[model samples]
Target: MSHPQAKIHRMSELVEPIATVTFSEVPNEAFLALGMRDYWDGYFAGRAAPLGQAPAEVVHAVFYNFADGEVARHIPWVWGKITPQEAIAVRERGTAAALRQLLGPLVGSPGLVRAADLATRAAVSAPTEGRALYAGLRTLDVPEDPVARLWHAATLLREHRGDGHNAALLAHGIGGTQAHVLMALSLGMKAEEFGRVHHLPRARLATVVDGLRGRGLVNADGGFTDAGREVKERIETLTDELAAPPYDVLSADELDELTAGLEPIAAAARGHDD
Candidate 1:
């Protein structure tokens, strides 16, 4: 039988993305055990299964694919009807506490703990940035052809460079729209492709393309114009500047020591999936 703690970790990873997308249904005990079936059936009723892939897919996408393993799959689902901001705050507190407990000698050192605190805060506050990045992408130079312009804008919009969440966090300091666009671009999307991923309605997507083209962010064919490239580069630079350095202020040995205990917890949480 799986350890009780391992099961709790899996359940926790499952809850966030469901919450992230604003799932109206609240997660409960059953949801934590057999997955979303119980929760969705109770809340979404008959229409729950088709809620865009199983909860596992979405969870895997977030924990493994999107965040690139920054968030462990084992952390328990946070209970309570809380806003994203509140959720982030709660997570940060927990992370800080955990680090202090697990890696006290290193994390408690001057500057390191402060950096860790800031990094956690930035990550938890990503959705705000998502909105900002989306907006910034709207201002790129327009191209002659309408379709080309749309494509151009679309490519910039979906850039998921370092990670979409990171882009979103950076967006908090910038604009959501800009962050969304950067996320699109980093993911290597064209304008039309972005529409599919974001599920933009036909009329709305078309209008956005037109508007971006008008603002010089895209070409008639829906691709980034020259100005769009400059905007993308600028956003990337800013994102790098704002992001926390890996292991900030910690010596290599210190970081390794810290990771030794934390890694097992992470492995146990992720079921050894790396």
Candidate 2:
């Protein structure tokens, strides 16, 4: 059997698509209805809403992955268009719509209800210390609707793990741009592809790559050196350990049920994306 931490990690991965479909896959109209300019604006506003009118620098610090100036472009500006509470409402509604479209009849099924219950229990049990995003999200009430409740639970767990991941990256002394480069290498993504996604200019990306090479974390060919691979593994392991405590509230059988219930839902969401 997998360690409880490993099982929790697997379940979190399965829940990600449900938790984040509104970020990219949801229609632009959902955001536009909130008086936002575009999806990027909605992205920044919705994700940061829990932080309650946070400035770009704060978002940059907590989000810990976007390129410099990326957060600034959308934040404060997005706040001008819509308040944080309103943005949260739109995000929740959009997520429910997307999940319904993907999940169909499974939205209210017993399996989904059981999974939501287990996930919510774990999320509520998670520690808030050192987890800024999750801590803020915990302030909001869980939605009453079943599909919305499931999405809410998944979002809580997602942010909990994300907060832990950022802490691990910080401990390893990785900066935002550098973290992207390492992630690309770890996931076998092209530098150009990942760089573009993060709004990293070619020159800036080259500088980050050169710095990683200086630290013996990257090779001349832009792949991970032995040290780089070791660092990445260590970071991931630490993140998983940090994320484990929440699921400690669940027993072995409950963890298995959560995974089983979410697997098909994740598959359906992935299938829709494909």
Candidate 3:
């Protein structure tokens, strides 16, 4: 059997790729470009502290409206100290105004202008299967930023793998059954034990268990096959290596504040089976 990790490890050893600037990169620019100009200044204005000090600040500052800031402050610190709903309303109004300003000339008629603006926004923001596949490719930790290699691996896996029900589960933020089974076996779970943890019926789970054995993604007797173990270890190593470096200049107090808000998100991600 072809070793999956050999390819993944080669890919992982490459550099991080230049993904399109996600909303997480520049909150103000992204929001404004998305026609949320009112939220444009709101990001920087919302707080004296590092905005991430608040839970969901990343989501709100970039993806949603900043009108949810609870503690009110000045122009530079213009935080919205209100409910999420209020913040959303403020964001909507700001976005509408910005779109009107940008598109007003082309859309001479006001009614048509509004419809055209909404249509444009929808087209820009709509998600697609290809985009999801692209996002998945972007998430892989390639060693030397070899995005093409990672894309190749994903392509290979998709073409050769079992039915995508398990893969879809992984994409949906649920752990992949196959991945979970591999993990359980890595942890030395017997077939019965693995079945129990997954709540799979003996017959169905055994089919997965046997499938893993055949693909060399798991092992007989429910232990990690050599290939399986290597893949899991390399993935863990790559995850740590690929994570953004901690800020060097952060004060102890500042670090604590940042961690407090981010800890939960990290924990939830780590706890994911896939």
Candidate 4:
């Protein structure tokens, strides 16, 4: 079981990618000039899935949950923005450039780097016997360029893990309101902000809160009760279990080497956000 405390260590690397990799370092002026679809096309180009061909709703439903109905509305517009091949090329160039800039001497370790990339990609490229999201993403064509393949591979794996988490959440009967409410502290999101973004109605949340309170799972403020904390920990541990198969593709030593090589790049990427 993944200890709840264990999750805290991993989140620093995961939380920002949806924003940074998508648009954080990107200049607002560029998006204004290019338009939304072009911006997204550039941002999301390489993946195991042709999200470009996917309806916005499909992409939104899979990615950003459609609960509040806010972010996914732009999907159709996003899908038609560019050819999959063009988008893949654009994505690969960007990854190669970033690797050169951030990795420095580590660029010499291309085989090791590629192995690291493949380890994570295994989640998607391998048969999705049980993964709902991985199976869906695997339908898209893999990129031919090595770097783009790496980028796409990592992303699909990341998202596959995310989807697995959602499934775990559902299996636990933790509704969206309770899940986000519980995650506010865990995810570093303010409760009010999370509620707003998810479009969770206060009244609905109140009812859920009441249920949790009755179960001794939460307090009046929706803070975790001891039982609540235990439940949350279990859910997180299960999520990690569901997401673990991909990393198993690498031996312990190989995985460590990959993490070491990627750490500088990941840190640099985080620096861009900071």
Candidate number achieving the greatest TM-score relative to the actual structure: 2
lDDT (Cα) of model 2: 0.85
lDDT per residue, candidate 4, 1-274, as tens digits? 1223343235325423421453433332233334544443444434413444665455555554445443454444444554555544444455555544444554546753563455445545454765655675576666655544555566566666677777788888776556777787466554556743345676765676687688887776657777888989888888877766666555556555655655555665554555
> Model 3, range 127-237, lDDT digits (tens) per residue?
223233223322333322122222222222221121222233334332345556656666777756754245556787687777777778666567877887776666454
Candidate 3 weakest ten by summed lDDT? 14-23
**Order of candidate numbers by lDDT, starting with the best:** 2, 4, 3, 1
What lDDT does the true structure give each of the candidates? 0.36, 0.85, 0.36, 0.55
Per-candidate RMSD, Å:
18.0, 1.8, 20.3, 4.9
> What is the alpha-carbon lDDT of model 1 when measured against the actual structure?
0.36
lDDT for 266 (candidate 3): 26
Candidates in order, TM-scores: namely 0.35, 0.95, 0.30, 0.70
> How many clashing pairs does model 4 include?
1
lDDT at position 79, candidate 4: 41
lDDT of 1 by residue, 135-240 (tens): 2323333333322222222222222222444553445332333344445655677644664235545565566567667778777876777876667767655544
In the range 1-274, model 2's lDDT, one tens digit per residue, is 2355667679768878878776656735688876887778888888999999989999999999888788899989988888999888988988888888888888889998888888898888977999999999999999988888888888998899999999999999998778878889898875667744445567878888899999999998889899999999999889888888778888888888889989988887765466
